[model samples]
Target: MNDKREVFYAKIMLFGEYSVICDSMGLTIPYAHFKGELSFINEDKYTDLEFAYESNRQLKKYSLYLQKLIDDGELIFEFDLSSFKKDIDKGLYFESSIPQGFGIGSSGALCAALYNEYGQNKIPNSRHISKKEILNLKKIFAQLESYFHGVSSGIDPLNCYLKHPIIIQGKADLSTVGIPRNKHDEKGAIFLINTGHAGMTEPLVKLFFEQCKQHSFYKSIRDEMIPFNNNCIKSLIKGETKEFFKNLRGLSKFLLKNMEPMIPETFKEIWNIGLDTSTYYLKLCGSGGGGFLLGFTEDLEKAKFELKKHNVELIPVYKNAKVIDTIKNI
Candidate 1:
C-alpha cells in the first residue's frame, strides 16, 4: 500500500495544430472533467491486481527504455523501477476516467500521475523552477511518452506536470498563463462539438507532415497559418474577441481549403454549415477525425439551433465573459 495523491486532469488545445509547430501561438487549459487519485487496496482486490499487472507490463517496457537513456546520459532523472514493479504486483493501477484518443490528454495524465508518484527528482510545486528547468522536465516527460503517439508534443505532459493553463508561443517557448474570465453571461463561448468517432493523432499528424512537404501547402501554412495564429493571440490578449473570432473564421477556412482531407468526409457538410451560416467557427481540437470539434460562437443558442440537425455533442467552454486569469490561489 502507498500514500494517497491526487492527479489532475488535462484539457485540449482548441486551436493550434500544425500551426503551433511553426512558432505560432497555442493555448491550452486543464479540464476538470476527470481526475484520478492514489489509494491503497487490500491484497484481496484481484481486479485491481489484474489492472496493475497490465499497466505494469506497459510501463515496465517504457521504464527500460528510459533507463537506457539515463545510462547514455541523455536523461537526467532516473526512477527506481524495482519498487514500482513491486507496487504494481500489490495492485497500483490508475483508477481514471479520462478517455483516450478523445483530444483530451489521457496518456499524458497517466504519465504525470506516474511521475508525481515515482520520479527521482520530483519537481517541487512550492518552489518555482526556471523556464529552462520546466522545459527540461517537459522533455523528459515527453521522452517517457513517445511510445504512445510516435512523436510527443511534450505540451500535454507539461500541462499535466504543471496542472495549469499554458500558452505556447513556439518551440521551447511556453509558460503558465491565466484563463480569461467571463462574468457577463455572454452567450459567446468556446465549445466542443463531438463528432462521435475517436481520432488517432499519429496518422493525422503524419498526413499533415506529408502535406507540409508540398511547396504550395508549405507556403500556405507559413504565410497563412503563422499570421492567423499570431493575430488570434493578439486579439484574445487585447480583449478584441470580435476580431479573435474573425481571425478564427479565417484560420478555419484556410484549414478547410488546404487541409480538406483531414476533415472527416461525414462532417464536411456540417463543417461547411458553420462557415456558411456564420453560426460558429469550427476548428480541429486535436488531430481531428471523429473526436471533439472545437467551436467558437458569439451566440450559443443560435449555434445550437443551427447545429441541431447534426448529431454533434456541444460542450460549453467559457461563459459570462471574463478574461482568463494567469494565476489562481490553490
Candidate 2:
C-alpha cells in the first residue's frame, strides 16, 4: 500500500568460491532466471497463502531484530521501520523463485529488496557507482543480512543490489566490470548441476576454516587455488579459452581432492569422468556440501550425455563468451 516494489535478481559467483576466503579475486553476477520482490498478500492474488503468511511473520521478526540492533547501537543506519512494520502487518511477503539453501543468493536478494525499500540515505544503483560507495554498501549490507545468517560478507546482497558483474581483486578491493560475452559459434559452456538438496553453509564453511588450520591444506590454498583461480578469472575475461580451461581443470581437480566432503556422495563418479575424459569439469557452486555444482565443458551436449546416466541435468550459466544462464549465489 506504500510505494511500488522492485524485483531483485539472484546472484551467481562464477569464480572465487574458496579462493575468496583467502583474499583472492572473486567474480559474481546477477541471474535473471530467478528473482524476488517485496509484495503484499491478497486473498484473491496470493496462491501460496501458507508460505506468504510465514514470510510475513519472519519479516516481522526481522524488523524487530533490526530495531534491536539500531537501538543497541550495533547498527547505526536508519530505516523506515514504521513503514516496514505496517507492511508486515498487512501480510507483506517476498515473492521469489530463487531456491533457498541452493547457493543461489536467496537471502541476498531478500536483503537487497528490503534495503532498497526501507533503508535511509541509501546509495542509489546508478551507472557510475564508485568503489568507495560499493564498499560502504557492503559494510552496511553485511550488518543487515546477518539477521538471516550469523556472519555474512555482504557480497551476496551487494551483487543483488548493484545488479552488475563484480570483480574482487582483494579483500577490500571491488568494482563492477564487464565480463566476456558468449559467442553464438562457440560450443564451450559453463553450467550448473542441481544436487536436489539444500547446502548448509555453516558446516561447509566451518569445514573450510578447519581445513585451513592444517599447514599443508592452507598452503595449497595460498599456492595452488589462489593462482589457478585468479588466472581462470583473468583468462575468461580476456577470451583466452585455452588458458581458461587449463586453470579451470587445475581448480576442479584441487576441489575434488581437498573438498570431497562438500561434493555430494552420488556425484563422485561423473565428476571424475569429466576430469578423466575431458567432457566437463565440475567445481563447487558455493561452499559445497550440496546445492548446485558449477561445471565447464567444451561441448554442452557431450557433458549432458555423460551426466544422463547419473540422472543429472545441467542448467548452462555460460557458453564461450556468452551468459547462457546465471549464478554462484548470495
Instruction: Please report, in order, the local distance difference test score of every candidate based on alpha carbons.
Output: 0.72, 0.84
Model 1 stretches astray by more than 4 angstroms: 37-57, 67-73, 126-129, 183-185, 320-330
CA RMSD of each candidate after superposition: 3.0, 2.6
Best by lDDT: 2
Candidate 2 lDDT, tens digit per residue, 182-278? Answer: 5222788878899889988877787888999999999999999989999988987776878888999999898888889989998887789899988
Poorest 10 consecutive residues of model 2 by lDDT?
321-330
Alpha-carbon TM-score of each model against the true structure: 0.88, 0.94
- Clash pairs, model 2 backbone: 12-327, 12-328, 13-327, 13-328, 105-330, 181-321, 181-322, 182-321, 182-322, 262-289
The Cα error of candidate 1 at residue 82, in Å, is: 2.1
Choose the strongest candidate by TM-score. Answer: 2
lDDT of 2 at 20: 91
